[model samples]
Target: MRGGGSKNSPLETLGENANLEISGDLISSSTTEKIFEVSTNLGNKIRLAHSSTSNGKVLKEHGYIYNVDAITGLKSITVAFEGELKLTTWYDDILNGQSVNLINNETSKLSGSDCAWFRIEALKETKIDSIKIEYTCDAKDGSFAYTSFDDLGNLDREGAKNKNVTVSLGERNFEQFEYAYDGVEANKYNQKAFVLGNTKLNKYNASVPNVGEYKFTFLNGIIKGGADVKNPDNTNNSHVFMLLPNHSDVVFENVIFDSTVSFHNEFYTNTWAYLNSLTFKNCTFNGGIFDFPAKELTITDCTFNKYINDNGQNDSNPIWVRSGAGQKGEVSLNKVTFTNNTVNAYRPVKFERLGINNNHFELTFLDNTFNMSTFNDTDLKNYGIYLDSGVTYHSFTLIDDGNVINGGNGDKVYAFNGVVDGNFPTKMGTKILDRNGNEKVIVGGKWKSIEEAKLCSSIDEVATDTNINVSSSGTAIDAIKSSFTGDNATKQSTTISLPSGNFSLKDETDRPSLKDKTVVFIGSGVNSTTYLANKSATGTEKGSDYSFDGAKLVVFKDMKISLGTANYNGFVRPQNLVFDNCLIEGMGHYWGDKTTFNNCKFSLSGADYNIYLYSGVDFTFKNCEFNSPTNRFMNAYREETSTEPIKVNITNCKFIGAEDTASAPNAKPVVNIKKYINPIWQITIKNSSLEGALNKEKGFYQAEEGSKGFVSIDGNVVWEAE
Candidate 1:
């Protein structure tokens, strides 16, 4: 029999020979502020029935043979149990004074026994000084099927600061373990820490969705996949851990992701999510893709071992950072490395630019090593790092410092537009081992080195003789300047030739001045002679308005003119300029009159206008090739008051895009005539074989509205659009 007790008296008393089976609600009076106890002398166990009171009160079950229900009120309850305590419902806001500690310690480990599932969901804006919880379940022979600690709904609401919650899980080995914290408000600044130890599991997954700060530390356990051991498959598609978007100031250390993991935005409307100041230290990723967009991302002392999966799909991108829909970000890889990494499917690291504006996207790779000896694929186009062509239109920067590539058949690093400053591998024919640990050799190539092969591909064999070999006395530009202004300065037309070598113009004072000079530069061949500008000098000069200007007739034949890292405005705009059988690479704006190109090739390297004509008249191209990967070939605009109309004539010419697509959908118009008030522009293409689809009519020229321009397409075979 049970009776009421005071603050000092006993609530229930059982005799030595009595057998009791209690089943009902144990209630306390509203005004009673007392301590309840049970006095037993028969060594019999007392059971607390699972019931709820009318008033807001907490009912906690301890010891053995007890089943607890939901608890409510401001007062906290400490339930310390020796045997298993079955928790069926949720308990929230059960504060005992200012702190609470709930401990569940089993006497011995049991096999096939289920551990308690705690859904610790805090109330809205609830405040507690500190809360400590510990759960331990040691299985002797077998493990629990599933164990989860999910923080459902919104926890840590606004103005709920310094909750100071700590959770510890020990010796609880389960087949599946999940810890999820979702919907944390932005203003809530809570310090939460989780310590997990010895919980060897078949599958474990965790997701932290809080905007505030949090920390997690894992120690001394192999948290792997399901029971298959070799092929540990899970129903949740093999994602181990996820740090959701807008999660900042979080640190995860000493965690081993032996299974696959992804940091993707699984359920979010905005494609461009922000994850700032998140760091992973001393982590190991076995096989999977790590694709996320972040700002100031740091990964130190990490190892990635990527391999193919069962479905014959190599979804192993070690590090893949993509630009958000409209946001800007940066990725930093420091002291990270990859080992046993095979490139059977995709590239190792890819920086994608999905956004239009990418001025703020930057990538830095420092002290990293990529071992590509295990790559078995025969695709030579595969690369260790691939910066796509979309970055050509954006302002992106790449810093690759102290990085080493052990072996690879394809390009080590491939970028479209960026300032690359590092000691990269220059020589080709470096032995690359395949998956069978055998060295592969390239056969039937003209050049032994890859650099030489690239140089030989663009060589023109128009002229074989060099008239006057103008070797550089100091600088190439200075020699050209001295040749035109020295005692042998000629008022008549002169031909200055150069031998088969590279001439670099690197200094500020190394700019050649060709004012009021008529010169023709001839070389041995297009590939043999190259004039390379310094990669650091800008195109703009102080005194002169143009890089090269004021020439009656300036001709360049059988040579390559490379504008290395120079802007469009940093070029020589000569009057009556002619190019014959030459390779004009890189980009520059040309403004002149009476210019002619015969059998010349103009190949642009970046996304810049190939030719910009200012007050151009009688410009003609015969059997020339205009090839640009992205930018337009020509942009011709006229002055309003000028009566001299800009005229461009193309005959027997070939206009090709990047990949020689018959209809180059990726290429801009071949000629774009701007609208002017004076309306003075004319374009004519005759007997030309154009390979790009530039306009709606599938023609080669595009004239602006209200511009007095005439586009005459005669006998031109315009290919179909791709």
Candidate 2:
């Protein structure tokens, strides 16, 4: 009764008087297509599984119904009816065929009807074109609760389920609804066959066409897994879900799918799985796993929550969300939110793609909020956004962003890329919370790009009084090519406007050599920067590498620099430098030998770093501030492989914060001088005040384990020491 009637005479079910006829009022026909009606008590469920090409149109009176919101006057529904509905294709019976006017004759609103309902009339042959489940819902309340279909064929229906409805139509009327049955084949209903929870589902071809105003929710418990053991050999590309739609802009929001239900494989796939030219808005994530094993995907206007469910220990960032394979794609998040649940949730998002390749992926966070419990936590000192360890992104953008660190931690964000765009606040007050209660912590300074960071100034701005201004007596060429580094340039008397931030002589394009140039910095508000120097265009100016003497550049008052790096490698020496009311980054290598800093604050919050230093001349610091989770001043190798000696001088400095047990240093500072075979000679620390936050074994000086060094603190108040 399901398929064709008897193989011998396939037309035996058709009587001699069984000719199909379609009138304006009714449909009359004699055929052997079985019919049935199905209904379910559940609110969100499936109904029929059949092999009838001419399924009937569900009548309004007989359809499984849902209650409506009284105020809205519309049904508050989340019903997915997956039964066969006959289309108005060709009419056939004992005779050849008959034409039918399937169009609704009651009203002349044909265009609106075609646009609203799921109706298709014209067809050549009868085939099951689609096994569709039409889901109707109102997001106003908890009207629809469906979960766990991303894990193919495995549906955990312990949550909310929908009711089902099915009906069969006469062959004559079936021809009227032929458009709804194009190229469809009757097969067993794979109720939840295309879901894979938090795991990956590769090579799925589910067609979604013209899906405007329809929201598809993929939510369920995902299975927890780790990196794949045989990633390279695994043939199936693991994915969380695969959305293959044609000419559809569907809304996918409020969906939760994790690895609790599926098998977790570390090297298996990417987080958020894969996408193809789709727009997702207002989605929330509750996991710390990341993956990038698919071709392409795009996400916009979403919230990612990564707080742990337990205590103070840092949770593992088990999620890997990125794009892999030769599938170029972009994922944009407008106003994306990422919040940690516990103190130890360090890195939330990590991109693994690196260098130049055809398979490119872009992740953007615009006007977003990233909240953390504290910024002072010693164990959780990492950026909210991070790239792959060795990966250098082509371009990354973090614009108009705000972050809150109620506890002790490090930077709010970090990146290694060609271009990074963000508002790098320079002043103490400028980086404060606004009227709306948004905090913009000026951790150090932000530059638009590596080129901008190199130039340090704008196109027309000249380094005068330690501030950027138009070169009144200099030359001006094209508007775009009017930087200070340009040679043989025409001077312009006209002044040009520039964006405001910290400006120093090091940011100038061409200011002679550090040994000869005595660049003066006297700006009111000069923040921190990595390093500023024009690229060695001809290889003769400053050689084809980083070469600067920090001793020669005399920095004046109103300046602050924290931890920063200027060179790609550790081959060049830090130029001669001096600081007055400036905070130099103390975390990195203090490459300058003849360097002097005065009346400046050097804390780990601003100018802290982990770089090594090689001093060869007088290294003096007086009337300065030194407070960091790590040591405020030091000198060492890039790694512990080099045994070079670090020589320096300290005088009349105020050490407020120290490297205590609570705030431990990321790397062991080379405070132990005995470890260095070369040994530091003529070291002096005189007339400096030390108090509030000092390690027991690390005061005036703590040599590396077994290094030879000397420490002296004279004429200063000492609070505590090891």
Candidate 3:
């Protein structure tokens, strides 16, 4: 039943490092739950299914660790599980009339409606102690099969009375148990048990569909000759033992995967899928490369050592997100934690988004140790946790809890090889949170809390044509043209990040519309005396708002763009435009959907409107101030082409009218809304102020007669007029 045959089992290939021996009358359990377990007259514990619920009722009869069969003369035992499937002398335990003789060396397999598979190797005569197992297996450096057995089938240990004891020798210190067996004590067997308790047919693969909840746990063993090869497909494949997405959970505790052979460790040779939840606790993964993509993956108190091979890797390879065409949906890895783990890989933790719909990818390190391994002949991609590029869908943020990562030759704990969007005070490294979740940063390995991240004119991320570090004095628009130098068909330089600089278009320039591009313009924060602005315009000739051919996300933060007579709308979008803590002067922004202006200021004197909304579904302005000296603060004439509704919310904002008293009386309302064909505008203005507007008494809003809209002010606005 456990893979059904002997030839399919792995042949013994144990390491010939030394001989082995154990040092006790019995090897006790090290885990707290199983440590106090003492074998009674009852036989082995018939576990229904190994789970977190360890101490409970068994078979509706006993709660003790063992249960007896109550048979005599070549004594037998009943393995009563929670399913009530008892293992006896009949086919109830064996299928094809294969009788189970509980002697030495031979094992019997049992399964039923409750259990999937279980193997009983050697039975005990009342006084034996090793342990039961869950889906997890324990690996041992030496073999457990002793060469000699007594007349009663007992081992050669002292106080050993009963028969059916299969002896094994090995040593290690996991929790409290100490195993330092003498190598010259006895003969040893050669076996390379990659997984314990599980048959070769049941080594969990992610690509396979789940049969049930897969929770494989490994505890306290030396895992040797381990290979974690992650080929695309066709080497070796398994369609069983899978993880149920959002349901499966596995843990490896106090284990070591030691691959001393230098390169036979190719475990999975297929398009590996993903892990729902997995953990490696107090484990050591030495000398091999493992590719693990997980939704919630945690590596705590583990050590990764000697990850070098004979041929060796060119550079450090990070997490694989498919360097080829991938499946649709959000390409993501979330809530990955490394706590108190020591890693000495070529380049520690690199995560690439793989030029797809990358939503959110983050690495949270708390009190871990990371150092570059200088002892590798292979070239290094020393940029740790480097994501080559970001998508136009969501911002890429770095939440550094805390770590001791060496910044060798300007090594970064995490980095982006290309464009990243957000209010980045720390260039490509944006929104790095501290232990308390405040904004933080890293300066030469050590991290420090900052009041805010400041933007500057530097290519802080990986030097790619997709990033533009604009210069005012030496160079200007070349950085802009260089950002679009890649192949336009694949949109290679699609999501470009514009660093802080005073970029001036000395002549009339019409920047080409970006199809499938989302540009994030960075600048110093609103409180900073330093600033990022479009260089003083040469003439008074303004252009239309920047229109994207096909865009997903656009953000401009801590920056200013004085579009005072520039024939180029360089930024803004049709979807997901979020601006924070920024200022705009003498310009109008055109937006369509999901647009938010938080903690910002906008002023466009002698212009038609500060905002010319093309279309909208959800628009918000929180803690903003708009000084529109010419007319309305905004005029929203939605496109009748889209069926999406218009939802505009303004909270804690101030819309000041014309500066001169004479012009204030002639100023238009705060917002001028035109009629739409189908969708109505549900506008809500709360805790806002309208000063010196022409129509402040009417809540400072004027909609056309046929306009389908409801402007709800809630009487919270402080309306004033000259």
Candidate 4:
């Protein structure tokens, strides 16, 4: 006989030498339910006998009796009580197809008893059907071990929809929970729906498959590093969710996430595949990064705290879409409403679309409160939206509305080193409302209300001046070039104000024509208006006469001219011209007669010379600085045989060498004069500072053997090459 007893067992000992025990295996028939009774005394053991039949004729073998035995010999057994008997068993045996109705509210006081709670192992090979479970256990406190549920178990078929199973876990707190249906096949006809509800899960990791819709509701979870079950070697312990290819929908509502989340590749080569849509509504994410690359992503009523690192390890800004060769698709952030959110990030969003053909990318920011206060790192201080460089795709658009970014450090909205001319936000200081009725303005290095700025004049009113303001509306260079020709040509004694912007002049036909015009071109400032020439004029006849024509008297003030690869002269043969507070950079030559300069600067790095005079004329320089690091200052090359020599006068002018320091011996000569048939060049330097010494013993000019020139240096300071 086999018998088991706890301290509260009802069986009693018969005598000092006789102990009572019982053992039985309950047997059942196909048609009827059987019942058994037990009756025992203090010193006697009871056991029931199996009967073959009631008569001699064998009772038609209806059902067999239950096998019963007793440690002490007994004749008959009878019931003494009327209440039902309850059984307690281990959960692990229940998972192995044990049939027992477990008591719902039983507590095991033992510390290491398997009958305390049930556990289901989510191994690679496990299958379970309809089960009801109710427990008040904590996985973190060692009450249960196998608490996580993973759907990647080895099933027989591709679709588990036929199983029709439901696991009702009631009011349990788990340390971690995982769900992944990666290998499931797509099923549009009878797609199944899995639901996990009423659980306060500490950690979560899920990847919805293509076959069905997965809904997670009322889940308060924290997903972070070291919470994942499949931790690959030599990788960060991060939580990743991939909406696999052909996935229908994954919804997360009424969930609070207190961990970092990423939606990118599983590894370097394993991308998240393709997803139709992913939606998040009414969620609070404490700190997380989103590297989502989906067809359509919708986020509404969410709060994001701290900075989010997008793709890689370095934390600068969150990259939304970086489309490359194999990652080309029509990705979009459709109808994202953060109306009840507070965002604190360095660079909030960075979108880059390259090598994507016939695909559109769109982003929309609506009704959100942004705090541009903190940064991912100290070096990444520009806390605003960062548009990646060279983001040229088929079509891209951005819709921003009702978003307030406060405490801005740098540009509130900045694009990288590329040209982005689509619907971009205006300058930060400008008062404007975005498309979604959001007031946005940057004030005192912070984003604030437009009314707080209290500007003295409106931007439109300040822009409408009486002077002829050059517009960079269309092709900037072409616009400026067109302004100098046709009926809109600059008139005499008129002020042509250049706008405060950069202009790219590429076409040769787009060069400004200032021939015979006596106009004064005023700029916003020396560093404000920049004219960048793109075409090269090397080895061309007009190389020395590029950008301008032989105007009579033109005045240029407060502007910057940048020469391209062309060895082009910025100004050519302006009879009587003046330059005031201008910066001429990368100019190959400057050929003009009777030219006067005041408070002007020149940066001629690899030029032939800073100034070249071919004819005998009066060129005066007062308070002008020339910075020619690698070339000569002045080159007087008179080819014609004339009795009149080129005359130049420099007063209070400073000539700086290419090498800024005094210890460099690479300084060039001050003046170089070529041999002429009738050499009579004259130069006067008084009250001026020359950084490098003159070329020859004549101090200011190096004339050929037969050439002659007069260089008068009076009260001038000369610096010898170190």
Report the poorest 10 consecutive residues by lDDT, candidate 1: 1-10
**Best first by lDDT, ranked:** 3, 4, 1, 2
The residue-by-residue lDDT of candidate 3 on 1-722, one tens digit each, is 21111111211211111111111221233333232222333222211111111222221221122111111111222332222222233211224323343422123333322222232222222211222222111112211111111121222222221211121111222121111112322422122323222112222232343423344443344644333333223111111112122223445555555542111111221133444555766666664433344455677767767464444363333223332121234432454676887777665454443324444445567876677654533333553444444321234454565566664324455544432222223334234456686443343221121122221121223223255555434233454455554444344333233344454323426554456555555554443322223344332223334444355655565666554433223233456666665676655444546887765678776556677665557888866778776656767675455565578888767887655546644455777777765457677887678775343543468777777757878644332221
Candidate 1: residue 615 Cα off by (Å): 23
Residue range 466-559, candidate 1, lDDT tens digits: 2245764433455556555556455334456777777643444655456766666666567678765334545553222343467666666667
Scored against the true structure, residue 45 in model 2 reaches a CA lDDT of 21
The prediction achieving the highest TM-score against the true structure is: 3
- Using all chains and alpha carbons, the TM-scores for the candidates as numbered come to 0.33, 0.30, 0.39, 0.32
* Cα lDDT, all candidates: 0.41, 0.32, 0.42, 0.42
Candidate 1 stretches greater than 4 Å from native: 1-223, 226-247, 269-273, 313-315, 325-347, 354-357, 381-383, 410-722
lDDT-better candidate, 1 vs 2: 1
Error of 3 at 510 (Å): 17
Pick the winner on lDDT between candidates 1 and 3.
3
In angstroms, the error of model 1 at 152 is 11
In model 3, the runs with Cα more than 4 Å from the true position are: 1-38, 41-212, 227-247, 260-274, 316-333, 354-358, 373-385, 390-397, 410-412, 419-431, 441-722
Candidate no. 4 TM-score = 0.32
- Given candidate 2, what's the lDDT at residue 675? 43
